[model samples]
Target chain A: MIPYSKEVLQHFNKPHNYGKMKNPDGVGEVGNIVCGDLMRLYIKVAKDKKGQEIIKDIKFETYGCLAAIASSSMLTDLVKGKTISEALDFDRKEIVEKLGGLPPVKIHCSVLAGDALIEAIHDYFNKNNKLIPEKLKLRHQQLQKEKQAIEERYKKDKAV
Target chain B: MKKVYLDYAATTPLDSEIKKAMLPYMDKEFGNASSLHSFGRMAKEAIEKARQQVAVFLNCRPDEIIFCGSATEADNLAILGAVKIAQKKGLKPHIITTAIEHSAVLEPFGQLEKEGVEVSYLSVGPEGIVRVGDIEKVLKPNTVLVSVMYANNEIGTIQPIAEIGTLLKKQSQKIIFHTDAVQAANYLGCDVQKLQVDLLTLSGHKIYGPKGAGVLFIRKGIAIEPMIYGGHQENGYRSGTENVAGVVGLGEAVGQIQKTKNEIQNIKRLRDELISNILQNISKTSLNGSREQRLPNNANISFAGAEGESILMALDQEGIAVSTGSACASGSLEPSHVLMALGLSPEKAHGSVRFTLGKYTTEQEIAYVLKVLPKVIERLRGISPVK
Candidate 1:
């Protein structure tokens, strides 16, 4: 049996922000049924009276286990009142800790939720004509490079 | 919320009486059954008594029963053993089996096929029942064995073993009929003579017994070469230190179920009602396997447009334990091939859930499941993109 924390189980049993947003400013969809998990995050980024682009609302739909649902639910709470930049800076460890930590096998769901949030913010900027932020782009590229290195190492090990 | 365990097809909880029956073997009387001392005599007597109990359940002579580590090992011994005997007699080995056999049987056959042995895979129709005529059609000049399962573990479809056994009896003297009866032994009476099966396999764990013990029933005079080479044990057919506690547990478990078959029937009645209510109350849900031609306590349902894992997780939250299919392959991303063989699309196959009832399953648990399940299915389907 999977020992999900009470907080995770609670959100899994009763998820918050669990539907598609209407005419959202940004939308991110990741994973699929074939992948054993999927998440769609929608955010409405509005210009606050101070002219800062802040997330006015957030919602998510995830098809996975308790950790996936809870991670997505917790994503909503973290991003709802934050500026687009703050939401983009949100880390998965904070989400996992808030839920009192998920099982190791289910940690992938948290990473997926975190990636979806950043993707949504990127979508927000792409729609607005602002240049893609250089630091986030470099960070994404760095992750790709590390992933490639890991794949190369795996291939070499397999060959050996 | 109350917890309901409905994955008996995967395994059953160890019966307490069986545990009690096995206590002495695990502790004080742990002497080797093969020794010549007084302790050995006591252990050997217990082994013989357990063998008698298994034979009583199988309705066969005790001499025909051979203990093995598991049904998989038994199946390998039966199939490969038959092939090896035929090969020694200068015969080309040919075997027939169904498409939906457990990997324990299929994987061994698959390896044999790679070694140039011919294997004819008889396909089942959408109802998941293998036609006896297909077996007859595939029977050949060199056919040495016909291996089919007595019951399917995934969708709970019981095969027409009596008919198959009768057909195999008339096919050829050389063609031995073997059926993996692991899932059927708990609910179905496995009288070897009545079924006309030359060999049968039973797993202890499937019938509330220990995990590491099983029986392979080879009718007297059927030639089977031993797979493992070692000192004589199991009459030279299998070799290993005997799993005495496990065998004892199996014998006691079988005896307990045999005496309580009537009470089990009552549980089956509640099982049938639970399936009926789920089908009646839930829309877009259909039974996966044969309704009438299945284990009395098995229910496999496919809820269209809802992922099986999600429904299973939801049910888990409510403490209603169920399964997507064989626990062996649940972690894989692939849908159950057994469901796909029964003519379900991959989507429908992925949406399938199996609920297998056991002796301990209760009507109140079913009521709790019925109360919680439809809501979970509806909520998941509401979020599903397919609908």
Candidate 2:
């Protein structure tokens, strides 16, 4: 069994803002079913006092190990009140540090959380017909490639 | 909190009676069986007695049972050795095995395939059973052997070994039939003649015996090449000094099973209750293998949206020990191949859990597990994103 930190277990047992939001402004779903880790992130955006678009609320649902669930829960807590640009700058490393660091095998869970946030931001931009930045587009393409690789590997393994 | 162990299919706790039977061999009676001394005779006699004990359980000749390091070695010897013997007769050896075989059998067949052997892997149906007709369709004049497991380790689905055995007997061509009966030895009667098997494999630790002991039953008049080339122990079939203490424990364990056969019904009743409760109380949960054809002590179920590893960890925290069909526990990210071969979706396969009862499993332990399992499943399902 993975030696999960007490904080990670706490978040996993009582995750905040779990479940789906009705008609959310932005949604991001990532990870593969074959890899046994999938996360769907939802965000409701609103204008703050300065007329800057900020994440008014966030929720996540994860199908994976303890670390994956905990990472998703922590990611929602970190980005709830932050501006869209500020949330985009939120690093997965900070999530890991806050969770007292995940096992090496489970570091991918933190990365998944980071990727879900980026995809949700992209969804927000796409909803408003705003141009997606080149860097975010590149990262999305890379995540797509990783997903294809995992699917191909799963197919080959099942064939064997 | 009291601990409840339900992972008997993985391995069982060594019975105290078996330990007692092994103690003398590990201490005072430490003479090599091959030596020409009085001590050697005593040691040799004890080895023969254990062999006879196993033979009585298997209903085979004492000389036919060859003790090896493990069931893995026995499986390797049966496949590689039989194929080598067929190769010596100027025939291209063809082998057939089921997809659900343990890695011990599959790896040897894989090595043989690399060495230019014709090998065919038969697929099992959703019931986790290989149709005898499928085996018949693949058999050829040069097919040297057919190896299938008697029971699956993950799902505990018992195969129709006797039916397959009977079909092979009707074939005009001589095709040696082998079954890895390691999982069936404890609860099932393994009469070689009645099963019509040419070779069979049994493991010690799986039957509440000591580890490092295994048996490969080779019928008389069958010629096979030896994989190990050293001292001509066990009539040159398996080479090395025997594991005396382990063999004694294996014999005692088999003897105990034979003596206590009546207790199996009690275990079956507990297993039935556990399965019915989990399926009835939990939503979106289903059993994996054939209900009627499965072992009496086995219950393999899958929760729709929960991940198996997380459920396992939660149960571990609650002092209930069980095993998951997910390969992640063994440091692999893939789900169970057995569950996959049974046509389960990857999500369902990844969420499977196996609970195998034992001779000592009681009603109270079953009730405790039933009480705790639903809460764990609900907890994991709440966190799952698959819905």
Candidate 3:
């Protein structure tokens, strides 16, 4: 078994902000079942006192190893009250740091968590008819390409 | 907190009795079995005695048992050596083995295929049992050997070995039948005459003996070319100085199985309870192999929407040891081929876990596992996105 940190185990054992939202403001789902690390992010966005958009609530559901689940939970906690732009800047490295650390092989899980958050923000922009940021648009395309590559690999493994 | 070990199918702790039997050889009686002195004669006698002890379980003669370095080597000697001998006798060498065989057996056949040997890999049914008809359908005029494992290491599914043995015995063309009984030797009776297998492979560490000791039983009058060439030890079949201490430990370990036969019922009861409780208490969980046809000490289950490596780590944190089908545990990225061959989807295969009981496993340990397992499943499923 991989040596999981105490904080990772805590988040994995009693994950915060789990389950689906009744009607989420923005929803983003990433990963495929074949890759064994699918994740879905739900966000409730609200305007703050100064009328700036802030994340009022966030929840995540993940299907993968301990590191994947811990990362998702930690990612939700990291971006709960942050402004939309701040959450966008919430990088994978910060998720690793918050969860203590993840193994090298599980670093991709933190990446997945970050990707899901970005995709959820993109969904918010698309639903509101706002122009998506150039950086997020690029990240979106990269995630799509990665998902496509994973699906192709799954097809090849099944063929074998 | 006490640690609970439930991965006996992988390997086992050496038995103290076997250790006691092996100490003299490693210490004072350290003479070469091939020497002519009195010390050498004593060592040779001890080796022969061990041979006879191992032979009793298989109902074979002492001379028919050839000690090797490990079960993997024994499997290679049986498959590669037999095919080579058949090729020497002007017979076209074709081999048949199941898809779920251990790497020890499958890799050798793969190597043979590269050498122009026609190899047929038989597929198993959903229960992980290879049908006798499937083996019969793949038989050819030049099929020189059929290798099947008596039981699987991952899922603990017991194959139809006796039936396959009988079918091969009825064939007009001579085909050497071999079974890797490394996992089966713990609970199953290995009477070769009853099974009708020409060659059988067994491991020492699996049966509570030391590692570096194994046995390949070649029936009388059957010949296979030697894989190792040296001082003509093991009747010129496995040519090297024998690991005398390991051999003695293995022999004593096998001999103790008969005395401990009654403990099997206890293990089976605990195993059954574990299976029933996990299936009953946990939702979206399913057993992996044929429940009735599996090893008495094994329970392999797949938890939907939860990855196996995560479950294994959670259980490990609780001081309970188990195994998972996830490739991450083995430092690979692919799930187990055995679970995949059973027609499980990639998701289910990735979610599978195996719990194998052993002679030393206690009822208290099973209860503790049962108490902690459902919570772990719930915790993981809560985080699962698949639902």
Candidate 4:
């Protein structure tokens, strides 16, 4: 049995933002075919009366396992109060850690959640004509390269 | 939160009696059957005794039984062995099997396909039993083996093995019939003569014995070649050091099942009651396979639209263990191929929960499950996107 932490189970049992927003500021979608786990992140980024850019609302729609649901719920909870920059800085490991560490098998699902959130934040910046931080962009590129390498390795193995 | 194990089809807990039967072999009586000494004689006698017990359970001669590592290896020996014999006779071999056979049978047939061996995967109807007519229709001049399973592992559907074997014997083609009786050996009445099959496979673990022990029953006159090459063992059929403890455990387990045959109906009734209670309490839920001709202990159901993993998780949290017809507890979330073959969509397949009853399952435990499962399904459904 997969050991989902109490916090993860609680959030998975009753997720925070479980539906679509009216018109989300930035929407990020991640498709995981290996496990058939799909997640969609809907972010509502706006300012209060003080004209400071703040996330007004964040919602998630996930069709996945407990780890996927909990990670999405935790992703929303972790990024709600943070600035766009801080939200972008949210790492996959931090999200996994926040859930008291998901099992090794399900770590990829948590990573998917983190990747989706960062993409959502980046989408928010892109739409607002704000430049994505150089570090996040570089990390994103690195992740893409790593994913490609893994896929290539799998293809080679399959060929053999 | 009471723990109840129903997935006995996947694997059964080792019975204490079988463990007791195996202990002496594992400790003081550990000796090679081929060795020339008192230790060897004791071990050899024990092995012969085990062979006799297994033969009695299957209603076959003691000489006909060959111990293998697992039923999978037994199946490989039977199918591949038959094909190689036919190939040597300058005949291009053809085989027939049901679409719903376990990977053990199907995967080997797949490998044989690469070697130009023609295979016909006969399809089962909505009832999930491969029709004898389908097998009749697919018979060829070179058909060497017709391999069918005694019972399906996923949906618990029992194939009409006796009828098929009887009909095949009348054909002039002389097709050597084989049935992978791994799932059906202990639970069902498996007499070799009544089934009229030349070969059959049985696994120990499925019937409350230690894992890694199985038997292959080859009728006295059947000719075959050994796939594994090594020192002569099991009359030069299966090669390797024998699993002495595992063999003793298997024999003991089979004996226990034989002694307890009267309790089969009671377990079936419990399974039926659990199915009836769940169906009566839950909404939009339906049984997956045939009702009348299924395993006595299986009740597979699909709760519409709700994710199976979430329900399984919720049930696990409540300490009631069950299995899904969808993804296994393994990391990947692929729905079960068995359900898909029955024409269920991936979504419907993902929603199927297989509640298999066992010897230790009680009415009160099932009642607890009947109470907790509906609430869990409702809760998961309430959170479901499709719902």
Candidate 5:
């Protein structure tokens, strides 16, 4: 068995931002079934007192392992109530640190959580016709490339 | 917390009676079997007695059983030893094995393949059962081995070992047939002559015995090279001082199986109940291997939307012990090669959980698992992104 941290187990046992969220501002679905991980994160964005957009609510539905789900759960907590910039700046490292630390092999789960956040923000920007950041564009391209690699590996495995 | 252990297929607890049988060897009677002293003779006597007991269990001669470190070593020695000797005889050797065999068996084949031996990994169907025709399909004139497992460790599907042995008998006597019977030794009676296997691997810990003991049944007249070298113990097939206590524990454990034969039926009953209740009560759940053709103690299932590790963690919190074949559950990123060989989707493979029952497993414990599992599955499904 992979030695999961207590926090990871707790979040996996009863994930906070779990379940399918209905009608969100943006939905970022990342990962794939073939790779054995998929995360669909939903966010509702509203303006604060200073007229700056802030995340009002967040939820996630993950089809993955314990670390994946826990990472997704932790992502929601860290990004909620933050402005768009703050949410994008939310480090995958912070997610790992807050979770007490995941097994080295499962660190990909945290990277995946960050990727889903970027995808969600990209979706949010796409929805409002806002200008996309170059960083977001680069990450989006990277995600697509990673997805193809996963699919290619899957095909090779199936062939085997 | 109400703790329940249901992972006997992984390894079983040491049986107390077997422990008592090993105690004297570990304490007062401790000695090197190779020494000329009386203590050494006593240890040698115990070692020889253990060998005799294992021989009786397998229905082979006492000299045929070679005590090894573990089943992994037995498997390595059996495959590498047999294949290497065949190669040494100046014949280009070809070997056949199922894709779903334990890594122990497969790794040696890989090693042989690197040494220019033609190796065929026959794929099993969705039921995780390898067919005899598949072996015949790949049977080359120079084929030296047909090393399929007696039963799978993950899915617990029993292969047609005796039938394969029979087929090999028709083909040629030159071809050595081996089976890793580690998972089947507890529930199934292994008569080496009846099975017609030239080599068979057995482990102690998988049964109610100590962890360190293992046996390789080398049918007499099958000359093979040794994997280890030093003290020339285990008939020089394996070297170094004998694991005296482990051999005694294994002997006592194998002996206990005959007396506890009826307990197999009880274990099957509990397994059936656990399997039935989980399949019936949990929606979107499916059994992974052949429902009827599996080991009496095994019930491997997949919950569609819930990943295996998530479900395992939930069950762990509930104080139940089980094992999962999910990629995430394993330290590696790769999912179970056994489940994947069955052509299950990666999702299903990542969700597979094996619940193996033991002699000590009771109906009440099965009921408790049935009670907790449905809720766990529902919770995970509720959180799952997959529809």
Candidate 6:
């Protein structure tokens, strides 16, 4: 068994912001069984006093290992009530760091959480017909390509 | 937290009596068995006694038992060693084995395939049981060996080893029949005549004996080309200074099994209760493999919405040791090959967990597991993206 950090085990044992969010402005599902990490994020968006969009609430549903679940739960805690732009600045490293550390092989799980966030924000922008940010678009495009390769790998190995 | 070990299929703890039997060989009597003096004679005498005990346990000739470092080595000796004799005789070898064999058997066959020897991997049905007809379908006149496990390591599904053994005997006097009986030796009380196998493998650590000692029973009159060469130990079949203490431990363990053979009923009762309650208390749960034809100590289950790794981690937190077929748990993206060969979807395989009982398992431990398991499964299901 992998030696998980105390923080990681705590979050995994009782993850926060883990469930469905009703009437959410956006939802994101990323990763797949092929990579051994499948996760979905739900977010509700609202306007702040300054008329800039902020995340009112967030939640996640993940089917994965300790690191994946811990990363998902930590991602939600990191970005729950932040402005959309601040949440957009979320890096995969922060989750790994906030959890103290993760195994090198499991760093990709944190990336999944970050990718799911980008996907959720993109969905929110598209749904509201808001001007999409350039950086979010590029990240979304990369995520799509990565997901396509993963799906192909799944198809290739299904014969086993 | 109270720790409960339910992963006996992985390996068993050393038995106290076996430890007592092995102590002197490790210390005072540690002389090399091949030396030319009283020290050597004493060590050699101890090893011979261990051999006779194992022979009695398996009902084979004492000289037929060869002690190796581990069950994996024993399996390699039985499979690869037997085929080398056929190679020397100038016969093209065709080997038949099930797709679910341990890597010890499979990897040797794989290497043989690369060397242009024909090999057939027999598939098992959803019950994880191999049919004798499948072996019959693939047997060729040149087939050298047919290796099947007496019971599966993962799901604890018992295979029809005796029937398959009988089939190979009736088909061709030339075909060598072998079974990896590492997991079956304790509860099954393997009698060589009853199993009718020309070659068989057993392990020490899997039956409450020390690790680093294993047995390969090769019937008399069957020839095997040795893999390792040196010191002329183990009839030149295996060539290392004997693992005296480990072999002594193994022999003691085997002797204890013969005495406690009837205790299997208690393990079966505990296992049945565990399986029944897990299914009844937890929703969307079902057992894997054929219930009636399964190992008495095994109860592999799949909880529909709970991912195996998460459940395993949760159970681990509560100090319960078990096993899972999930990809993440193994640090590999592939689910268990044995479960896949049983025709389970990858998702179902990911949800599967193995809980094996042993003689040490108590009713109180079972109750505690039943109490903790449902809550953990329910918690994981709540977080699962599936449902």
Q: Which candidate is the best by DockQ?
A: 5
lDDT per residue for candidate 1 within B161-235, as digits (tens), equals 999888877754668999999998878889999999988999989888889988999999899999998878889
State in Å the error of residue B378, model 2: 1.4
Candidate order by DockQ, highest to lowest? 5, 6, 2, 3, 4, 1
What TM-score does the A-chain of candidate 2 achieve? 0.94
Model 2: per-residue Cα lDDT over B242-276, one tens digit each: 88888888888777777657878998999999999
What digit string (tens of lDDT, one per residue) describes model 3 on residues B50-95? 9999999899999999999999999999999999999999988889
Report the Cα lDDT for candidate 1: 0.82
* lDDT (C-alpha, whole model) for all candidates: 0.82, 0.89, 0.91, 0.82, 0.89, 0.89
Report chain A TM-scores, every model. Answer: 0.83, 0.94, 0.95, 0.79, 0.93, 0.94
TM-score of 3: 0.91
Evaluate candidate 6 and give its CAPRI docking class based on DockQ.
medium
When sorted by TM-score, best at the front, the candidate numbers are 5, 6, 2, 3, 4, 1
Name the docking class for model 3.
medium
* DockQ for each numbered candidate: 0.21, 0.60, 0.58, 0.25, 0.74, 0.64
What is the C-alpha lDDT profile of model 5 across A1-160, one tens digit per residue? 6677889887887789888778888888888877678899899899999999988999999988889999999989899999998888888899999999998989999999988988888889999999999998888888889889988987887776
* Per-prediction CA RMSD (Å): 5.5, 2.5, 2.7, 5.0, 1.3, 1.9
Off-target runs (Cα >4 Å) in candidate 3 are A46-56, A77-101, A152-160, B87-92, B114-116
Stretches > 4 Å off in candidate 1: A5-7, A34-38, A49-52, A78-160, B84-92, B113-118, B326-329
* Model 1 residue pairs with clashes: none
Q: List the pairs of residues colliding in candidate 4.
A: B6-B356
Which prediction has more favorable DockQ, 1 or 3?
3
- lDDT for predicted candidate 4 compared with the true structure: 0.82
Error of 6 at A152 (Å): 4.9
